[model samples]
Target: MRPLTDQEMKVVLDKLANYMSDLKSLIAPLEDGDRYVFRLNHNRVYYVKLSLANLATCVGRDALLSLGTCLGKMTKSGKFRLHITALPILARGARHKIWVKENGAQPFLYGSNIVKAHVGRWSEDCPEHQGCVVYSMADIPLGFGVTARSTTEARRLDPTGIVCFRQADCGEYLRDEDTLFAG
Candidate 1:
């Protein structure tokens, strides 16, 4: 509701840094470009190992779309599990002020009220908070940046490369199709 002050920004940034480190560690065992599928409880979790360069590409492509791209980037194996890399992290980068606005990023820049490298999405409706979360170009570090905002305005805001979804009670996304979904 109110502007994010300098102190608030730092806290979120701290969270993002720890998150990225944990994420990097998680994927460290997997070879670069390798994808993994894990079944957590009855739900499925997909992961892919990727570098910063590949992450940049995803940001460029998914930045302008109205609905954040879904599991289009997931690599499929067997029948249930899908493999995906740090698309969510890339997505947070794409929206970072540091990445600079690429093609089709204007509209998204205007509406969002928040953007931070450490804020990750807990629900399907995440990102595109416009200048509210906009971080300085120098604030981003070379790792995964989590992005988030209130669920109420998610559909209306359009930060570039944001992911949008409505989750079911079972923790499974009803449907997802990001540009990166396995080809």
Candidate 2:
């Protein structure tokens, strides 16, 4: 990954602005601390690690590691895209949530798409391709997904098939996590 160009930075800033209104202010500090870009190919930044002065600025804080991290990708046309991680979603600031039961949540964390049958309830306004926080029945955030279909279409689809595409989940980063089940 590479540090985004000024134009690319503006695109990322606009996308994240919805969730983090103060994202631009963090850029200077991020540059000063430690800046490294993990890229998928040669142009897109997939993960970014940066520092922050206060824990309130981000989800995790450790003296040995940088905080205020984000996961993103570059579009085929070279536009930067950002997605929220499970850690930050747990902070309770996420706007869209797709609620699932234990059975569904388990598979989802293992990187399975949310089948229509397993979807219990969801934020009605969640649009396709937008990031949505996945919540367990108990209201704990399980991970994040990009909506594959609109609310109305999802409700109309066959219940046994996939609905939302999984992005990242708690299991991949947490232990006791059995690998994704073949079933």
Candidate 3:
């Protein structure tokens, strides 16, 4: 319902940059027509078009449950947490990715961390602790998580070793139904 402050914008961009190598490339398409803009409402950040945002101004903040795509939410401690709703945008330009095997897909969707045995493949040169998107063998994005080891290090990890730490998963949309869309 309001524009993001300069500092807040920086934080959001920084968090996004963790998934994509180029920040401008990630944002260029959204701003292509100059019709889209980012807005903040009740700690949640939305990517909405200018025209819709203009119209939304006429509505009271309390009544505006949501607008556009919910990219993520700003936490109480000032950290930005990317939401599962942002999977499409993040997957498009993801710098590093981990593809889970068919048998592992169910567990990952259920919020379990990806184990080394379940890793079907991963981006080359992926570094330790880097943010990466998780996908199924069929190329469907299941979630996003942080790497537990570097590419080389993972090569020597045991089958039971944790490969990716779950951050957010698509299943949250159903599991968190009550609060996800609540204003």
Highest lDDT scorer: 3
Which lDDT tens digits does candidate 3 get at residues 1-183?
Answer: 899999999999899989977667644545456556789999999988787899999999888999988999999999998999888888988999999999999999998999999999999999999999999999999999999999999999999999899998989999988888664
Q: lDDT for each of the candidates? A: 0.30, 0.60, 0.90
Q: TM-score each candidate.
A: 0.19, 0.59, 0.94
- Candidate 2 structure quality by residue, lDDT tens digits, 31-75: 356653432323334344433223233533232232234455557
**Which is better, 2 or 3, measured by lDDT?**
3
Candidate 1 residue lDDT tens string, 9-90: 3443343342233334433455555543221111222222234223433443334231212222111332222212333443
Candidate maximizing TM-score: 3
| Residue ranges of candidate 3 with Cα displaced over 4 Å | 29-32
Give the least accurate 10-residue stretch of model 2, judged by summed lDDT.
Answer: 174-183
Question: Clashes per prediction?
Answer: 30, 1, 0
Q: Which of the two candidates, 2 or 3, achieves a greater TM-score against the reference?
A: 3
Worst 10 residues of 3 by lDDT: 26-35
Q: Which window of 10 residues has the lowest lDDT sum in candidate 1?
A: 165-174
